[model samples]
Target chain A: MVQPEQIKQWIEAGLDGARVTVVGDGHHFEAVIVSPAFDDKSMVQQHQLVYQVLGEKMKEEIHALSMRTLTPEQAAQQGE
Target chain B: MSVQDRIKEQIVSEKIMLYMKGTPQFPQCGFSGKTVQILQACGARFGAVDVLADPEIRQGIKDYSNWPTIPQLYINGEFIGGCDIITELYQKGELQKMVMAAQG
Candidate 1:
């Protein structure tokens, strides 16, 4: 149901300049996200932001998600 | 006495262990990949065994931890949790402290 492309679309819609990598077996996903919107938020809040982007897709299709959210600075520090 | 027991014993015998989908060098699944990244970022020495490579260990781990998931993390003979919990812990900076304390 919640295909990878839909995730990409949702992220692109929610954030102006967000980099998202979606990896999983369809039902479960591991997302590596770098967004300027995550600059001052706590990790939980960052994850919540991403989830909000997904909207109702989380309940309808996505079963599980393992997220690695970082600000652009963090991502840059990680050499990504 | 059983496969589960053997798996438990293995986990208990190892100080820092990860029962993942594939070896640390070649993680077969995305969850396992993220687990490895978090562990690496902690800068702790760890051992990772590929459950997918062995059917016995794969099923045994589920029974050993009573957790039906790959990328299970164990520290000092205790089951920490799966990828989500690990990521959460890592984000909170608790994982680094835990690994450091364990190493010490």
Candidate 2:
């Protein structure tokens, strides 16, 4: 039963210049993360970066997580 | 053979492979169900493995791809991400392109 804020904090703490928003009911979470680290990575790699931040929690604490990873540029582009 | 090797063989055997929670017709999880819908929408002929049915694969797959969730997609032996990424790619029409290219 992990809180969304905790997940957000974990990602923010691990990633540099990351803006993370997570919403969930303790188990299944949906996260939208924008970071400079995602700049040149593929979608799989981008998610992997976030997964690394979550670490072992992904195996036990977080039962499910659906995420949208974006570079700051891509996030801004989505605004248009 | 190691579980990783078995997973590797499975991926290469099918151009499109989905390691999901259940069968496509009876997906056990919402994420897995949604993934099946997206693949069906793309008219993709994919091989599906029910992670829930096999504990070894359920655990092995996560380690195999370093992906922490179910409903993982693989196209032409490449990990394409899970349900969220799959839906995003399908919405962007990239998945259709990949499926078409895979078929040819």
Candidate 3:
């Protein structure tokens, strides 16, 4: 099973200055990610990038995910 | 006829319904909060049931929709999906159109 710490590690590996939170009920998770890497990406692309970080864990361990990807500016604007 | 049955009936009868983690007034999770924001932005006047308050509703929703997630949205008595799907649809302007059509 992919734990929250694993998600944090993945975020730290791919996103140097990202703020990521992974909340889940063991099997399913909701990830809120704010990264400078999202500055020039569409929402789909942003989600794809985060998915890439999870890689095989998404397919093998995690059953479902509710993800919200945002640039730092967008996150700041939403105050989220 | 039980609580789950009533919840299912309510979902089917309501034009726009969200089976979410918390009420719109007090969202318990970030994803549910964002889902509410997206619905509000789409100008949707919908019914929201807090799944977190009732364990039966939370588990029953998955069985009802065959979707193992909270923050599920239903429009016109159809299961649209969970928070991610809702946000994605909202961003593409599809959700607004669907809601408008349903309201008419």
Q: Whose TM-score is greatest here?
A: 2
Cα error of candidate 3 at position B4, Å: 4.5
Task: Please list the residue runs of candidate 3 whose C-alpha ends up more than 4 Å from where it truly belongs after superposition.
Answer: A1-64, A67-80
TM-score of chain B of each: 0.94, 0.97, 0.92
Candidate 3 lDDT at B47 equals 93
Model 3 CA lDDT for position B45: 89
Error of 3 at B89 (Å): 0.8
**iRMS of each prediction in angstroms?**
7.3, 0.9, 6.2
True contacts kept of 2: 1.00
DockQ by candidate, in order: 0.11, 0.88, 0.15
lDDT of 1 at A28: 73
Q: For residues B1-104, what per-residue lDDT tens digits would candidate 2 score against the true structure?
A: 98889898988888999999989999999999999999999999999999998899999999989888898899889989888899999999999999999988
Q: Please identify which of the two predictions, 2 or 3, would achieve the higher lDDT against the true structure.
A: 2
| Minimal lDDT window, size 10, model 2 chain B | B64-73
Residue-wise C-alpha lDDT for candidate 1, range B1-104, written one tens digit per residue: 78877787888666889998878888988889988999999997898888877898887886665455577889998878778778889888999999999899
Regions of model 2 farther than 4 Å from truth: none
TM-score of chain A of each: 0.88, 0.96, 0.87
Per-residue lDDT tens digits for candidate 3, residues A1-80, read 77876776787688758898888877777788889998998655566677677666665777777778888898999998
Per-model TM-score versus the true fold? 0.60, 0.95, 0.60
DockQ of 1: 0.11
**lDDT string, candidate 2, A26-79, tens digits:** 978989999999999999999999999989988889899989998999999996
